[model samples]
Target: MALVDVDLALIGYGGATSLLLDALDRHGVRGLRIATVDPVETARPHRTWAFWTGPRDAFDPILDAAWSHVDLYGPGGAQRLELAPMRYAMVRSGPVFARADEAADRLGVQAVRASAAALDDDGTSVTVRDAGGAAIVRAAWALDSRPTAPHRPGRTFWLQHFRGWWVRADRDVFDPSSAILMDFRTPQPAHGVSFGYVLPTGPRTGLIEYTEFSPARLDDAGYETALRSYLKLLDLPELAVEEVEDGAIPMTDAPFARRPSPRVVRLGTAGGATRPSTGYTFSAMRRQAEGIAAALAAGGDPVPPAAYPRRHLWMDAVALRAWDRGLVAAPAFFERLFTRNPPGRVLRFLDGLTSPAEEVALMGSTPLLPMARAAAGDLLARIVR
Candidate 1:
């Protein structure tokens, strides 16, 4: 029948929209009608996100914990890395959603609880339709965060999958000062690479996970086996498992369609926020939300910017080819990276923030010959195809 008309409508109210609303609130933008289309409101989050950034950001208030340094464990030994200008932060999704809801209410943003099945974009406005072909809402612009299965046809794909446990022990077992970014001491996977990640909230409390980068995800029992094996490496007392978090992030070289139509744009992972190599997405989406907020406030186009430059994407594609083809030994590869290069440089490079010369230096630290060959092969394969 009638529609909930607004200036802008968000198809999903997860991290991307929340961050956008948070930034808009911070910038004191007002007088525009906004609405969010989501099927259900989340009361609790079974997931956690970990990201590294320089300085503070909008989500700092709800940050569960932060670490100024991190431990990188490899075949040789463990090295304590000082993240000077940057700090690693963790945020649970439940609190993040709550914060966004509060902001939406204050800004008078409406919520339509319906699944957006289709978006029809005219030159001036977009109409969101549900599965039954009913108009759910209409807006001048639509930012769709809905994610499809990441298995894109005809693209190189990989999975960054993990199962983590929030555990506590009576004994002070963890060095809480620095989080463990990667522990390669855990048994390596037969196909891809495997590592242990630890984020200690305290001496006896932390989230420990067994992570793998491979073509497919492991089953529940497979994850349990790997996690238990990793836990044994840490000398501790009987553990109390407080929570469990499990998920798979798609790592792909497929170019995402940012604009489905003139008035409809994509956000979050579907918009190319996840890095193909590391599966880190929060930081990229966070940066983009801020940009979108600024543009809307300044009476400018609010399209989300490219998450990373084409050159950076090309480099990541080459790395993926190498890893997928078994051209480089990942454990020793990453081991030498952290040991030989400045930790900040490596972290920046992962974010695609490093300069060309710096990138060359970093590439020099890897198996240069193998990577160069991989890059050449990747180029030729694309050309012939």
Candidate 2:
């Protein structure tokens, strides 16, 4: 076994870990030795990350694309909407990977390509295997961003699985400046919701995705069939698919531990940073990275932030509980909220922003009977405990 020492050790180099490195460099924390291990040859490559932003986002320097217009389509039809003061932006996985790697090289941080085997409870140490045998490393703090196993005893768990096709056609069939928010004309699962999302990258190129927020995943043929149906429904002709991107995002009531131990901190999805309501984590990742970098620089043991705001968690719990009980329609719940609230406000709410007053008003847009019953029952159980 080989052993090395550093100030920090990172497990993965996804959005969260990469952003932290960038922040640390910007703070002029020079010559800080950090080691990272990820067997994955490159960072995110096959996924697209989209987030809602107020003006002048912190990570705008590396933002790959942005759009100002938003549209929502329901069973009724397409509703065109505009956000004057807010923007919806997307960052591709490859560019994020490149930016992180470039910063690491310039900052002289040690980047190791290895798979982690285990970590000691002492928390500051880890064991990983490279091409050779076992290698042991020690740091003042270690952050693991790998997805944690879900373990919510009685609650149901579902994954939001999606397949996006980057397409270019001979003719323009997509709006270059607007995001197709959701087309709920598709079939819904008996237990959950499903829809299509489109983000126009350019006049001739864009990403069209078929997504499902259900407990189960579709077979290969099932996803293909769904995509075919969606394309047909939108009256898109035989467009060549430039690329296919697919992945899964977990949604569970599982209590993901923020700090696994005093010495080990978790980040990203592994730290339960995924928002329960919408499964959005890009912006949350930025927040987590900022906190982590500051703590590391100050020589304090770092701990992950609570995954979501308390209010947002409560709202998600209410919605998920209602979904589990078959009391509310997912499409209708979203439709009413979007119809009543401005697109920016609704997006912010989904992205875990809003005042208490705004939250209450947004909740009121829904048929309250189902969510109220769920919240009441949840509170009663808490009281009993």
Candidate 3:
């Protein structure tokens, strides 16, 4: 068969790729054939992603639901706060993916179920291949989001792998209006951070997750044990498990080759959209997709924005260092922050919504000794290298 040609070739169909396709339609970036290739069977089952947003944004239409109040539980107590002028939103992966898929079809983009096997880079054009052989895709630009092996280049890159159980109780046991932000009563790892996350879908339905920010992932037994212990502590024995969701998100500084070539780029977590500290990527991926589409529409560069700014990177470095040194208590630090700071400001900080001054003050809240050392060390490393 003859080779195919397109204006843009997207190599993955995950959140980032889907968002890109949607952006293309929204921005009216036309006159280009696009091909999105992915190994469909590899997509994991549905998982829930929760985020806090201000007003209407690019993805407001797709949000499955929203909550006005979020509750934080720690050693101190429970602090319930309304996310003023903002709402906490949750969207299921299945629906999000389906919506994007339908939008892509409406935009007249070809969707392929095969994966990209290889790439041939020339100065002007980019070529992508599949398992059939060196099948060519002549395109002005090609983007890829296939997973890559972990890179530990003189630094540690941890993952926040978690397994969550969607459970329903015989009686009303959960507070439908409140989403449990974190429960610090859980055991913290010696070298990393660990905590429990609960999002209530209804009075009897919620998802309880066993989360860890460690260099490796937990075994099935480990996750189940932690979740069981948490539930037992909460005295919820009558709850029955209705569904299970699990995922591993990479948190690292391994310089992702975002701009691989003149006509080639990367997007999504594969392009380092995942936060180095929190392992959240959904909203960042949305912003990235919009940027790329806007740039392409105006005959501009299509490289997605670096999800983490310099200040945000520094904040991550400082926090990770403090956690690494065992200087800060996992639950206590978060508890204090949530108790002291307004929910909106704190949520914005977590969502990468703050000025440099605010970011500095946020970092200053950490234990002075360890955080100071980390900041100084980070500066020195930058100077030396």
Candidate 4:
């Protein structure tokens, strides 16, 4: 068969691709032949995407829930931080994907149900193949948002694994106004950190999750055990689980190749959208999508901008190193951070929007000795590498 030609080819129709498609549509960039390759038949499974941003965000239209007050619990006590003018928002994947599909249909973008086999870029055009080694399509430019290269042994890497259950109680047992960002009362792991996250949708319904940042993933049974333990700690009434969601997100300071080739660009987590410390990607992915759309609109090469700010990257590296080396206690570190600094400042820092002075102030809130040691060690490791 003759090779099919398109203006652009998107390998995976996930968060990044959807955002890019949305941006393209908003900019009135239409009538271009585009193809999306993915194996999933329908929309992706039900998962929640959460991020902290100002009161008004581009994604507010699709937000399922938002909380202005977040609670943090540790050995010290509980701290309720008010995020005025900024709120933490959560959007269900089902709705977001449905919206994206609608946009794709309106924009005349084709969806192919096949896994990508190979990608070849030769300056002028890019070609992609299916798993059967058959030519899928050729395009002027292709954005490959497939899974990233595997983490090599000895590389500083961590996995943010989580299992969440949507539960309904027999009676009102949750405060819908406040979300529990972290509850460290649960059993702590030997290494890394573990916490419970709660997002109450109603007085009797909520999503509770057991999340961990560790070198390795936990089994299904392990997660269930932890969830049971957390529920017991909460001492809520009998509950019925309506749904369950599980996922593992990569958290690393390792470099990701943004431009694998002149014509093929990487997107999403593959392009380093995952924040090293918090494992947040949606906001960063949105920023990257906007950048690509702007570049294309300007008739320039659509290479995505840097995934994250340089200073933010440095802070993430240092924090990851500190956690990996067990230089500081996870609960204590977080308690200090939330207790010492204004909630908005900490949230802004986590979102990579804080200025240099704000960042310095945030750093000063933490234990100086451990941070200094971690910074020095990270510097030495980078120098020797």
Candidate 5:
């Protein structure tokens, strides 16, 4: 049997790998052969990726929309925040995946339509196989961006589950200039919290989602019922559903190894790109892709940097514990954070780009006693185990 040789073999053609391809193109690193493996021909599904950043971002070319202001509604009432010098941007996955696929084709990267049944790496090369046959890809390195296996039980785990509908109305009912970041008027869960998110693309059309942060996920029927109830609450006459998008994102502090072997590295959610506190991963994955590309171009090891700063991880641990224990009300905690700190600072903190002073100020906005107790309990549990 003949073996296939390339500079890199990507295990999945998802967001993380796509971003890596984009970075490689940007760096003008061409002529390196590559192979991508994925079972699906199209991207996972129609979905929207939203993140906060300034006007200049690496993904500006594929941005679907951007909002300069965001609204937060809670028990304290509606607070409209102006995120000047920063924008809340939304990018649809279709465009991003298509662009990446085009770039791969242009660069002469081979797309292998098969599931990777097995992977064997020996510090110099990685050989992957499928039931149909086997192919030994000799390369300096390989990247596996496949979705990670389920988290082990008894590890602090939560899910940011959501179902959204792209809706259109007969009359103008949405303001396209701003987004409704969180509307806590929805029914709250006994264990966690629920909110409604609105991203208006036009005066009469937008994507409205019912999102929940909880230990368990809801069935499709459950999400549909919630969405219907929310639409009734809005009382928008002549509303029509254009499309639907739903997904479950893991929110856990469970450790995910980035470098599973000396020559093979993990990417995307498999590499801890998803933040434990907030289910935000696009920006983190982009940063990881950039780092990986730069390292490979420099003839250095392409090990991804830590998914997040140590301090940020500690904060996430305490917050997750406190929320799971119901020590503090999730809606009120978030409302207070947005109410006390400036929106830009909060966005930066969520993006893991906050300074020491900003972090301290942000911490001061939370329920101190509950967080302290949660931190202490977590520490004691770690010591005992």
Candidate 6:
């Protein structure tokens, strides 16, 4: 088998690899030999990644939409939260793929169109064997960003599944200045909860989605019924369905390994970027990519650091435990948080950027006693394990 050597090997180029290449390109890391391995010819899936961040992006050319404020509806009532420093933005995969390709080409990123059959890290270097049993890439460091599935069930697990419809109406039916972060006005599941969110690309059109954080997923008919009912509740004009988007993200407190071996580091969801309480991965994934790329460009160790701090992960574990045990109701829990906390605090907390003082105040907005008990139980379970 022919062996090709590189300075760094990216086992998958779907999302994280693309961003890493983009960051490396922007850094102008000269003469850094990189190989990206993925069997797919194009990773341009019709997906939308939403994240709350500052107003600037290196990929602003492809941004689908951005909102300065968001609306929240819960059992108590409806409220609007203004986002001053941070804006919620959506980016389409097609544009991201295109932009990343441009950057990869400019940075001289070698593309390897092969499925990874095996990875061997021998402490000194890492080797990647393709599905055809060829040792295609050997490098001092490797970033394995292969897409992961939901396995290793945690004590608390939920499927954050959703179906979105991109529709356009004859008249202006959407508000471009703001988006609906969460609308708990939708029907609730017996075991979990249901909500809806709208991202307005324009005043007359946008994508509306019905989402649930439940242990089980709905059948085709069930999802259709729920989404149709939600649309009816909004009382919107008859619109032309332009496209459909759907996917499911696993929200679990299970530990994800960042490094499978000494020289091989994981990235994206495999590296524990997804938040357990809120199925948000884009911001974390981007953050990790930038950090790793920056370190590499500066001639530092490129092994990924923990996506979220230990304290934050512990808090997430406790929150997930409370959610699974029904100690804190999802709808009411979020409602109280948004209503009690100042604007942008909850969003920052979700982004894992909240300070300790902000977190303490945010915790006060919940059922403190019950949450504390849940935290204690989680801690005890971990200790026993």
What's the residue-level lDDT of 83 in candidate 1? Answer: 88
TM-scores, all models, native as reference = 0.96, 0.92, 0.92, 0.95, 0.95, 0.96
Whole-structure CA lDDT of model 3: 0.76
Candidate 1 lDDT tens digits, 1-385: 3689999899987788887887777777789899999888655345788888777866778887888899888878888888877889998888877777778888899888888999999889999999999997989999988786443442468889999999998888888778989998888777889999899988889999999999999989999999888888875567999999998888888777777789988888888888988899988888788888889889888786788888888888888888888898778788887778998898888777889998888888989889998899879878986
- Native-to-model Cα distance after best TM-score fit, residue 159 in candidate 4, in Å: 0.9
lDDT (tens digit, per residue) of candidate 4 on 292-376: 8888777777787887788898888888889889898878888988898989898887777889999889999888999899999
Instruction: Please provide, for model 2 over 190-271, each residue's C-alpha lDDT reduced to its tens digit, 9 standing for 90 to 100.
Output: 8789999888877777888999998888888888999989988888889889899888887766667777677677888878
Global fold similarity of model 6 (TM-score): 0.96
Against the true structure, candidate 6 has what lDDT?
0.85
Rank ordering of all candidates by lDDT, starting from the highest: 4, 5, 6, 1, 2, 3
Candidate 3 residues lying further than 4 Å off, grouped into runs, are 41-44, 57-61, 131-133, 149-154, 380-385
Residue lDDT tens for model 3, 1-385: 3577887888877767777888888888877788887768555457788777776656677765667877767778877878868888787877777767777777778766666888777968788887777675677788887776533352446787888999988888877777777777788777787778778878778888888888898889999899998888787867789999888997765566666677778787767677777888887888788888889889886777777686786777666656666666657777766666667777878778787777666666656786777777766766886
What's the lDDT for candidate 2?
0.77
Worst 10 residues of 6 by lDDT: 146-155
Write model 6 residue lDDT over 1-385, tens digit each, in one string: 4677998888887777777777777776768888887888854567889998787877677799988889999998889888887888999887777778988888788888788888889999988997767788899888988866544657787879999889898998888999999999998988888999989899888999999998888988888898788889899878788998888887888877788788888888898889888889988888888888788788887876788877787888888788888898889888988899987898889988899999999999988988999999997988887
lDDT of 5 by residue, 1-385 (tens): 3466787889988888888888877766677888887778854676789988896877787787899999999998899999989999999988887777777877789877778877778867778877665764556678999887644433478999999999999899988999999999999999999999889999998999999999999998999999988887777676799899989998887777777878888999988888888899998998898888787688777787877888998888888889999897889999999999988999999888899899999999999999899889878867886
Clashing pairs in 3: none
Candidate 5: where are CA atoms >4 Å away?
42-44, 150-154
lDDT values, one for every candidate: 0.85, 0.77, 0.76, 0.86, 0.85, 0.85
